[model samples]
Target: MPKKRILHGRIVLKDDIISGYLEVENGKITGISLAKPAISTETEFFDYGSQYIFPGFIDAHVHSFSNPDEGFEATSIGAAVGGVTTFVDMPYDRPHPIDNAAQFNQKAAKIAGHSVVDIALWGTIPKVDGVSEIPGLVKAGAAAFKMSTFETDPFRFPKISDVDIYNSLALLKHSKIITAFHSENNEMIVELIRRLKEADKVYPRAHMMSRPIIVETTAVQRLCEIAKWTGGKLHIVHVSAPETVDIIEAYRQQGVDVTCETCYQYLLLDVHDLERMGPRAKMNPPLREPETVSGLWQRLAAGKINYITSDHVPWPAEAKQKGDQNIFLAPSGLPGIELLVLAMFDAGVATGKLSPQVFAQLLATNVAARFGFKNKGQIVLGKDADFAIIDPSQTTTITDAGLHTRTDAITPLAGKTLAGQVTATWLRGRPIYQRGQVVAPMDYGEFVPGAEFGNQLAPGGDGLVFEA
Candidate 1:
């Protein structure tokens, strides 16, 4: 609303950290100065003292509008407070699936006034390609077309056939919209499920055992080949295996137009946590062993994993309770939209798994480049004044009262102690979340579009946190 200056702190930028002041005017960053610039009395100033400010997080793979009761308002409450300013949501829903243009438009209408942060929508492959409106949805601004080799639902999420996938990729070959897949070989999973059940291995380990690394590797290997043949922009979602990263990296080295995203669950937790928490920690492409988890972290730090996301799923306690009787029956998703950035800062950044430069890349920079978010994912002039002012001086414990999921209960990550806490989140130069509360209006959020695969993306950034 007013010309403002963020002063007297270490400013984080793409390559070098400047101990300076940042200027914002009309919802955009206009300047970065090494010294306090002469200012008029009309200019408001907020000295950050010694806090670390980073670009607001962009989470790309979260489940929203997957049910009638679900919308962006409740989740964006968590997102805003938790430092996510933009999110690309999944296409599965109970009453309306985002398989066609009309359905996509209807869901967009549903979230019109409810979103509190920038929202992007994903479309899906329908059972019948003849009837599916992929081109129309793409023209209507779908971020990507999502399909799964492993079906999560019959009517809502049937597995796409290989022929269908190849045809769809061929159709999308030159299109800017990328094709994303949930890659797990369904046939192998079915057989493993049968064997695990016959042996009466009903423990949480069964979930992991049933879908071993091969399940993901095989699917990834095959999908890479299909994607190569069809020349479609391909991306794999919520990858859980180190081998999956290896496969994708190998393809990248070969110069394939492909990328893959991993989740916070795989990076922060392991099978033991799932064993203890049961279905609360249960998720597809399930969490791996301790060694595998270690390997994944190394891969991420080494820049093999393209980016990270929450894969934020919010299945109620009721369903998970039923899943407790049988891990297979347990819904596969862990709610983490509110915890992804903070928890990673706690585990990855503070522990030196990633430098601030690399951490920024993992959460926002790489994401923006991969998905073609030309406007965001960095703190720089001419971009939206979106940032998360973090208090890295103290520890914050995640608790039930601090969560903002639609369920209003704790997430799987609750009770974990994180290194830094987000004090405020600014979207378009406006403070939407502050002091552990979301203060933005329902109408503040708008839909953001993905640019072409090789769009002119914003530059990456790094920062120094001088002790106050």
Candidate 2:
């Protein structure tokens, strides 16, 4: 690629946004200039009068599973339109799950040209006995491994046993790969549902009441114990309850290798939203009450939350309405890839709960460092020149037309106007999403192979990974 320069913008740096221009060469940031430069023909330039340039957001949790209506292309379109240049996709795909080397390779090959932005894949153990296949999955280039304590599907998304959890942790110990989990006690949820059904009780609120605080706190507690026992690097995902945050923070203080991420919905919306939205707002680790919401916001400001994501699963309107009268019959999860960055910005930073810098860390920096994306998550010199141009002066009202998900375009964030507007998104110094369309080709995305696998572990490869 030829040299390129992005001129006359407010650049978001480590501590704060600065008035400056940037130079890129070979798809990496090579220099930063604080002063306005005279126009030159040495390089092509994309001029931004006064837009805010933020490190292109990286949503660490998303799903492009083999849904009939939505997959790599649809999700990538939503991602690009939403200003996300990079995302980590979950491993639950239809017909085939990514649990072994062959399956992983096949999925990687399938998504090769279908994405419009950079992507990373999360590998999962498809079944209880699948832990033995982690080595091959890792060797085939999985960025991280994901699992759930509660079963959504027996073979596709099973509740991993304690023995398997210990075994997975042991296998990944010192590997630098973080084993991520959807932490919630299976039996507790099952028994709660059984009791609710037997008592002839059913309501939207029953979903929240069934998975009480203990359900998540208990699973988080168990995960911490297993991780400590096996010396594994663990990450708890979609932590809705503040109790889970308290648990992970306390465990980290004790020196166990641990980290956790709260979903964007957890911080921005609550039980009332769920009650009003029903299956449309349904998700694992159900939304909490008002008081819990207040407490979570406080913790979010305190920096107890390591990062945030949109466990982005876009179920169709019919699928959500299938349960109809019964909340139990309705599937869990919702679409948020197009809403995450803006939602967080509107709720956190613009509202004074998060400083501009901290918000950037949550969406980008912390995630890159936690996982092993060596060149991502920051706007530093030599880093990949991925960025989202923000027009802070602009505000947008959420609507079906404004959204890019393949299914129901209406989101929990609909109706309300948000403060920041993403005008353009660039990946590796090249434009991917610009002026509300994907300018980059389907094959523009490159699979980032796991840096820990091949060359790193061969010969003088340093095995010291996941230390942070």
Candidate 3:
């Protein structure tokens, strides 16, 4: 570690944009000053003229290394280039399911150094009685635990019961952690799918029919109730409906420890686009009507939605297409990791709809606070020196040709111009990306667990049980 380093220019410090100099020592920010300071020995300086330095983004949800050859190192690199310095990935569909402490530890070791930025893992508590593994996964370094409301493949997904959800929440509450759920009603969606198939309405639009907006709102209502009853912190991920946002708002008003996150696709694109893009644009909690998209943006701009993420599940285009026009057969995600920050900045912040301060809160600070990432998401003294240097006035067209994701499913934002670009990104004072190119190796990354709980369990350690 160096004795000191100074970075100066337009700095977004502590949720405010102000012209100041930032000082770092021992890989943490030590000072922010308008007055120049005397240089210490071994001090280095980096001056980003006219560029804005904001807290590096925290992608709260993503999927990587979930299966053999399914990991996206190139997409993770794209994430670095796009101003994301920390990624929290979901654990499902992996060669090893992260249900127990042992599997969580094993996955951690597998991705040990193969990251472009700091990475964290989300552990899943199967809907089955196996949820007993929750505490152990947390001890093993899972910053948060995950459960799904909808069951996809019978073998891959275990339909969580009301009892199962409560037990898992109790376990998480005992472990002093938050539980995030994919809030879609499984039975309702299955019934709708059954009807759609019987009516032979099995088109891309039928997929949306099977997962009507009501499912999300209903599940959110149930989850919030569970959170209130258990006093367990809850976060609803990839919320796709306006009514669901209203439900979250109601929960918050009632003093429920509930927060919600929405994705870029929901804000920028509408359900109609899915017709053109076919399965590529399709995802769980499918895109909604244009009015719903507008309403989601309205809430986002109002700061009702607590955080933002890519939900970036990247599969190769060939694999995503799956030999048919049926959206049901297509994989459930698109690559938005690279575009998340830039797209949000372009569509939200630049439109005067969201202030830069709110951007910081939604994309970086809130994520760090929510996930307990102590040394990240702020330029505070003793905090990690991670930042995104953006040229707010610069314009760029989003295109797959320039992206770093291994897959080639182009963003719908292509041909749509954006007002800003991520010129550089730094992870703990090291410039890992500059001018759209990665300067670091895929394995140069490190697994960043919360400072709240250090590693007490290994990749395959025994599951820890908490007293109920």
* Candidate 1: worst-modelled 10 consecutive residues by lDDT: 456-465
Q: What digit string (tens of lDDT, one per residue) describes model 2 on residues 1-468?
A: 376666558888889788888877778988788976555676777777688788889999988884556788888888888888889988887767788888888878867889888888888996657777788888888999998899888877778888788878887786878899988889899999999988766677788988998999999999999888778889998888888889988898989999988888888778888788787777888889988878777777788888999998887777888655778888888888988988888887778878878988999999999988998889998999988887878886887556687656347776889998888888898778877778999998877666565523212122223466
Judge candidate 2 against the unseen true structure and give its global Cα lDDT, from 0 to 1. 0.82
Measured over all alpha carbons after superposition, the RMSD of each candidate to the real structure, in angstroms, is 7.9, 3.6, 3.7
TM-score of each: 0.93, 0.95, 0.92
- Regions of model 1 farther than 4 Å from truth: 1-8, 130-132, 408-410, 452-468
Please identify model 2 stretches exceeding 4 Å from their true place.
Answer: 407-409, 455-468
Better of 1 and 2 by lDDT: 2
**Each model's total of backbone clashes:** 4, 0, 4
Q: In order, what lDDT does every prediction score?
A: 0.80, 0.82, 0.79
Q: Alpha carbon lDDT of residue 39, candidate 2? A: 58
Q: Score residue 77 of candidate 3 by CA lDDT.
A: 86
Best by TM-score: 2
